[model samples]
Target: MDDPPRVGSTDVAVLPSDGGTNQPTVTEAPTTPTVTDSPAPTGDRTDPEQVAREFMTTYPRDVRELSDPTFLASLEGVNTALLDQVTDRSLEQAGHDSDETYERYAYTVTGTYQGQVQAFYSMVVARPAEPGEGGGAAENDLPFQVHSFDWAPGMIGDEDRPGPAAGKPVPITTEEREELIGQVRTDVIDPILTFDPDESPEQRQERLDELTVEPSTVTPPMSRSGRYAMIKETLSQTYSTEHGGPITITYAGTWVDPYDPTHNGSWSLTAAMAREDDDGFVVRSVEETAPSEGSG
Candidate 1:
């Protein structure tokens, strides 16, 4: 007989304890550890604006800390008691139906290396569950789920076009501009196309048409490594926003259809110092995609 195999998280396993034993020996049964799903967090303020502000402040700090991969990995053994509390409460208040549903709203870094941030924004098309079957919350019923979750540094940011409005015409500060551009090229664009398995030849052509860029002409080649240059060249034009604060800079421009550059689309990019980290800033999140490059 051989040593009994250890049971795993999924199910129990049985094995002989000794090869030479004449009589059958019983091995101690593995005990199942009790795991209680934690409760959610609660906010004291009733105002939505106040809640949003609090969320903006606290989450960013957490994000800043999460930027450190080695430190984050080492914390795997530690219980996320407080973090779970807040996330759970927020989900419950929002009436999210299932943990899986909340996951759709949340983003995760799929793969990363060398301190570069890698991520993907995916569509979570969850249908409403029937009665007696668990389903996502009312809010979860959408064509697509969206959120910006960064796994590593230099993961994502603004396209190379104009800065967000609300600042001087030469909107971005010297230090801030470089950081913002770094993020856009490294973080936001890389992950989306890298994980886009369906973006094959046919899909690439379709993407070209959708993005309104010339097909068959590989200005710099559209591989993941060269996507930043392609995107930068594609979106060189700029626009600005009306409102302003914190000397922030925002820009509005067209998201070109990569497949067909002749077509026009509308898009916007914004840049500002991260409220949590004095040295950092984020591109917020993106909004709708249009057909042409100029306005999309």
Candidate 2:
């Protein structure tokens, strides 16, 4: 049987040999650039949404790419339509600046795996509040920080989508998605994001122990402090009130590796119910389920 759903899961593709130059054309700091509509061209395959989904799927597995400038540059052959969709949706969902200009900083690049085509997504975010005037060496040198990521499954690959046998496959239910996300926050992502090397070992263990327990759907842990709290709050309000039904989520990427300090070296998969609860959903329990065939 397949493992249950759990929490998890950006774009950018730039194609080579196209009319446009490979080097970045826009140089100004991305302080809300005026985005213009591009002339329609033929044969664009890389889609932003697909790129985002691809980003989710691949990023965790290839952590080295995060720091690789050349690898980041090579992913330009992706379909912009998918890339745009995913970036637009994520930016809106994250409440980051979602203006069309943001797309200029995003890209979709494709890769081949097992004779199959895959995509990677990335965003070049401008660092906030830098010294010195705009449009100078600082602007040219690492002006926009490149955060490279992979396509997430549900939104990009065949596995993430509804099976053709099932008709337009149902998206993993929002309730299920949110619940899994909550558990991930509590158990994995949040702890690692908030870890303080300065804290006493006992305190660290205490926090880790708290994480081992299943989290309440209504009040989940957050990875980093500050804005992360707001993300949690937003999820709580959006999901618990509307989609707070029984659901399960599974951690599918780097989150599963034990050696990784990136996310507490733990990833989770969850199974949940279809309806809501008065106390809101509390994790009934946690256990390792059997992995699907071929995964083991």
Candidate 3:
């Protein structure tokens, strides 16, 4: 028989993905990146929120903790569809909350699983002192423990789209495709264009010019901060110059990342150069777009 809804059960109740109206975001699917092994948290864990955050950050349970048994119990209310996702191999951005009512916890989790699918859902916990056990008779004995978990299932394979057609009057060879990608990196991508919603073309160019010829400004984490982001994978192909005159041979491609291995997003670009000229294959422009659902 299913367990009864108790004090902390409300915390485990399914929550909205957007946390608005307490409604789930069912209309839109989530993104799935490829699963990758990430470092786990170690050291002191004196707080319940800390433990729950750790569970959400690097979930899938590479190693269980003393708190896991109760944490798992808290999850009993979660549906099987969503519970299956708890074995996440790679978790994405997670949101969390706790209630004073029952000392409850709620987590909105998303991550990549082994099959390259995005598993998203919610986990709620009703955290309160359990019946007195002999181990610690003292009232002040402290250790924020979990009593139960509530769950709500989200999407499994989202954040992926369809591939672009490689239809060109003349098909470029595999070698040509690789060559074109390399050229695009230097001529177009290297100079780098920062995305700005309101910025104009001239403004973008001006901003690009002001920057030094250095890689992007992302600061590499000194160590595993437990923060995770899905790595997006790119695949490319080239077309014949005959398809488009001045455009020469067009290069088209699709994106497939760690999550949602099933979906592929479209991307393409054009360049101008002679057939035999390697350096001459200068990039005229490039376009890397994400699906409306949003993916790498």
The candidate that wins on lDDT is: 3
Estimated TM-score for each candidate: 0.22, 0.23, 0.24
Candidate 2 off by > 4 Å:
1-104, 110-126, 129-142, 152-155, 160-207, 210-296
Q: Write the per-residue lDDT of candidate 1 for residues 123-201, one digit (tens) a residue.
A: 1111212222354344332222111121111222224542211111111221232244444434433332332434565
> What TM-score would candidate 1 get against the native?
0.22
C-alpha positional error of residue 100 in candidate 1 after TM-score superposition, expressed in Å: 51
lDDT, model 1, position 149: 21
Model 2, 209-291: lDDT tens digits are: 44333332322222333123112111221111112233333333222222323422222333232211111222333334332
Candidate 3 residue-wise lDDT at 16: 11
* lDDT winner, 1 or 3: 3
Off by over 4 Å in 1: 1-173, 189-195, 198-233, 237-241, 245-273, 293-296
lDDT (Cα) of model 2:
0.30
Compare the candidates by TM-score and give the number of the best one.
Answer: 3
Worst lDDT run of 10 residues, candidate 2, spans 9-18
**Relative to the unseen true structure, what is the C-alpha lDDT of residue 40 in candidate 1, on a scale of 0 to 100?**
34
Rank order (by lDDT, best first) = 3, 2, 1
Distance (Å) between predicted and true CA of 174, model 2? 18
RMSD of 2: 18.8
